[model samples]
Target: MLHLILPSDLDALRELLDENPESLLDVAAVVNCLGTCGLCERRFVPVAPLVESLEPLYGDSKGLHALLRHNQYISLSEAICGFCHADPGLLNMFQKMKKL
Candidate 1:
């Protein structure tokens, strides 16, 4: 299956983050795949609840430890700048909303 972080996916993620900032750790900043990008295509997969786990961080450091070792978390600043700078190949597919 094709897995990519598309513009819509990013937008949805942003909304999700706004609603649930705690999920920050569960998300992966980038995923790459080749296909029609950002058309909201049924074929294009969305990354959400799937990559994110609902479990809270317990005293056990395994989850946080693994995240730190993995080094996959993107800073809030970087996530804000994600609009102009995302996976280049994926950015190429971003369909900017047209003004009416």
Candidate 2:
């Protein structure tokens, strides 16, 4: 569950590496904890999440208007830089989902 690599998930992180192998391990410690950070682990990007932005529908007395917000996407530049710069696989637990 930590390193949930698949055909598509590999595509999403294809560009982010420093041994993003390290980043792979970075995500491992988290998934290991159903008792620790379980049930809420989806926040850590389990699959190559193609999460769409919620276009807010402003309900008014006038009419039910749905406004599509502009420029909601975030750049992965910083995150990529961080993964590339930081320690690679400190836990080094790339093979398993849990530390233990």
Candidate 3:
């Protein structure tokens, strides 16, 4: 049961990174701090490699062009297609505002 970070969480993290440029390490630390029951925690997965792997895949012909066209490669999971994640909270909020 990987407690995946919601879209809002990612957005918040991005904003945090922007605000405290020196806290880049802290940002990584927080992202790696998954809950005890999640797949990330169980597997002890480090986010560094994941972030590295997504760098080159963000550009064209990488199969993620559509999803990451506007977003820089900030993290691995962030590079994932929004449609694939289908975050419930984000979708619900968008629906309420008629923005979906």
lDDT of 2 by residue, 1-94 (tens): 4345422343344333212323433432444311112211222222111111111211121211111111112112212222222334522332
User: Which stretches in model 2 have alpha-carbon errors above 4 Å?
Assistant: 1-9, 17-19, 33-100
Q: In lDDT terms, how accurate is model 2?
A: 0.25
Off by over 4 Å in 3: 1-8, 27-50, 53-100
Ranking by TM-score: 3, 1, 2
Q: Is candidate 2 or candidate 3 better by TM-score?
A: 3
Clashing pairs in 3: none
| lDDT by candidate, in order shown | 0.32, 0.25, 0.34
| Candidate 2: residue pairs that collide | 22-89
Candidate 1 residue 67 Cα shift, in angstroms, is 18
Give lDDT tens digits, candidate 3, residues 3-77. Answer: 232123544544543454333333334455321211122222223343443333222224332232333222234
Which whole-number lDDT from 0 to 100 does residue 98 have in model 3? 52
Q: Evaluated with TM-score, which candidate comes out highest?
A: 3
| Residue pairs with clashing backbones, model 1 | none
lDDT of 1 by residue, 41-99 (tens): 21221222223332232222344333333222222121112323345653444434322
